[model samples]
Target: MHRLYVEEITETDGLIRLSGQNAHYLTNVLRQREGDNVLLFDSSGQVFDATITDAGAKEVVLKLTLQYRPKEEQSVAIVLCQGLIKGTKMDYVVEKATECGVSEIIPFYSTRCQFTETRKLARWNKIAIEASRQSQRVTVPVIKAPVSFSDLLSMIKNQTDSRSYIFYEKGGTSLKSQVLPDDIKTIYTIVGSEGGFSPQEISEAEATGVTALYLGSRVLRSETASLASVLLLQFMFGDMVYS
Candidate 1:
């Protein structure tokens, strides 16, 4: 079944109106018609089975049939504290990170960051939503506005019951050496931009209690590093479990 993301869904059984972009997507883009069934999900982590009751040029109405709430599992929240990279690279990070089960993305501007002026929160959010839909995720990752490096440090320092790590190409503890804490509620992984992190920035982050991690001897692009860090952390701490 095709899955569509709605901002919120309150009624468990009723006719729901979908207009604007969503309506156009179902009617024109997907060529869905009346009586077609679609899966609808919202940020509340609820999935609904809906059948198209009315299909019009301006709007499409869906009748909620059933609600399915997945079994809750023990998972750590992953937050990517990414250094602002230039152009489409940042967009790729947001898209892939959401698919990789990242809970939140915080783009920060460090000393080595190239692009610090423009904030693409809207574009990133759109990418996140599409990625979530494609990945069959019930909830979309929150893409926060870019913040300064110092501000990012402060935010990490203030977060309780969370473990933070900064991936530095220079040198740091390997992922295998660190032990995953069972009580950790959130995991914050920091990756630098094309220029990478400066020594001073690494020191500042370390002083703020962020562990420095190295992704082996291979040099990776800014976008590659961002995805790698998220995926690795997800496997160890988040929802990427081996069955």
Candidate 2:
């Protein structure tokens, strides 16, 4: 069954009206017709089975029924603090990070970042939503607006019950040496841009209780590092465990 993201699916036992882009996506893009069954998910982490009742040009109505709700909430939340990279590379990071089960993404501006004034939160959120729909994630990751590198560090410093790690190519402790606390609630994985992080930036981050991590000897691109770090964290602490 096809899945679509609806911001809010209020009436679970009745008809729900979808207009504008939602309607266009179903009726036009997906060629959905009346009687077609579709799955709808909301930000509340609820999935509903929706049957298309009417597939009009501008409006599509769905008959909704409660389908699934997560049995338990995720204990560990993974957040990606990605340095702003070039155009499409940043988009790729957002898309793949969402698929990797990141709970939130914060784009930050650093000294070595090429695009300082880039603001693509809306586009990134769209990509996240689409990725969530494809990945069968009931909840979409929150993509925050770009912030200064200092602000990012401050945010990590102020967070409670969280462990932040900055992946630096220069040198840092290996992941194996660092024993992650089982009770840690949030994991912040910071990845630098194409130019990577400066020595001063890494020092500031370290002062804020952010541990410097090394992803082996090989250097990776900004996007690759972001995805790799998040996936590794997810497998260790988040929801990517073996069945």
Candidate 3:
């Protein structure tokens, strides 16, 4: 069954309304109609099996069947503090990071970042929505607007019950050597832009308690490095639930 994320839903209420682009997708693109079955997920991490009760021009209503699955979240939550990159690279990072079970994604401006504030943030949010649906995630990760390096450092340092890591080529320690704290439910990993993080910025992050970790001898692109680091963290601290 096709899955979608909805903001408005109630258990045992027997009704769900999907409007906006999702309704359009089902109506025109997927060609789905009344009586078709699909899955709906809410931010609460609940998946409901629902049947299409009505498909109209303005909205699509689904009849709540029952809870399809229980709440299933990754053991180790990951928030990717990704540096702003050019073009669609940020889109790719959001999509893949969703698939990799990142709990949240924060795009920030670094010393070497190439994007400006005028760029469309809605497009990035849409990519995250689609990716979450495609990856069967029960909840879409929270994405924040771009922030400055110093502000990001402050936020990371203030995070409660979570560790922070920065994936850099010059990182002295391998990622595998580090372990998630027993009480920590989440971890934040920061990745630099095409030009990587400046030494001063790295020092600031380190001063804020973000550990630097190395991938390997060969350097990877921004997107590749971000995705790989998240995957490795999940593998070590959390099971490969998507598999």
Candidate 4:
């Protein structure tokens, strides 16, 4: 069954109002009719089986039938602080980041970023939402607007309690060497734009607790690094052990 995220869901009432593009999806694209089953999530960490009761221009009504175990969320809350990139590259980052189990994605502007602030942020959020639904993730990773390099540094300074790591080509240590306690609940990973972070910016980040670590010897694109970090982190601490 297809998955959909709704803002509000009621267990007792057993109904959900699907709106926006999703309505268009069910009505036209999927050609779903009354009694067709689909999965619904409220972003509250639960999955409910629902069937369409009605479909209309603005919204679709779903009747909840069964509720299953809450979808498995990442045990480690990793935030991907990615530098703004051009066009669909950011979209690819958002989609892959969610699938690999990132808790949130922060789109911040760096010195060498190509796109303007308004353009990239707008598109990144939509990509995140769609990816979360497609992956059956209970929570959609929050995609924050693009902030400046200086502003990011200040925010990092304020986040003294959280563990932060930056993927840098010149890094001396491997990201795998960062010892995350079994009980560690959250982590923050930063990946730079195509040109990578400036030396001054890297130093500033270090001052605010963002330790630089190399993914490998070779330089990778921002999207590739973002996905690689998330997957590696998950394998280190998450269910990737089964594989």
lDDT per residue, candidate 3, 4-34, as tens digits? 7776566446787888887998888888899
**Candidate 1 residue-wise lDDT, 46-92, digit = tens:** 88999999999998999999989753533788898888888898889
Q: What is the C-alpha lDDT of each candidate?
A: 0.88, 0.89, 0.84, 0.79
Candidate 2 per-residue lDDT over residues 49-140, each given as its tens digit: 98998999888989986577653436888999999998799899989999888899999989998777766788899999999999888899
Runs of candidate 3 with Cα error greater than 4 angstroms are 10-13, 116-118, 241-243
What local lDDT score does residue 54 receive in model 3, on the 0 to 100 scale? 97
* Total clashes in model 4, counting residue pairs 3 or more apart in sequence or in different chains: 0
- Candidate 2 backbone clash number: 0
Model 4, runs deviating above 4 Å: 10-12
TM-score of every model versus the real structure: 0.95, 0.95, 0.92, 0.89
Clash number for each model: 0, 0, 0, 0
Candidate 1 at 207: error in angstroms?
0.5
> lDDT rank, highest first?
2, 1, 3, 4
Cα-based lDDT at residue 97, candidate 3: 93
Model 3 error, position 98 (Å): 0.6
RMSD of each: 1.5, 1.5, 2.0, 2.2
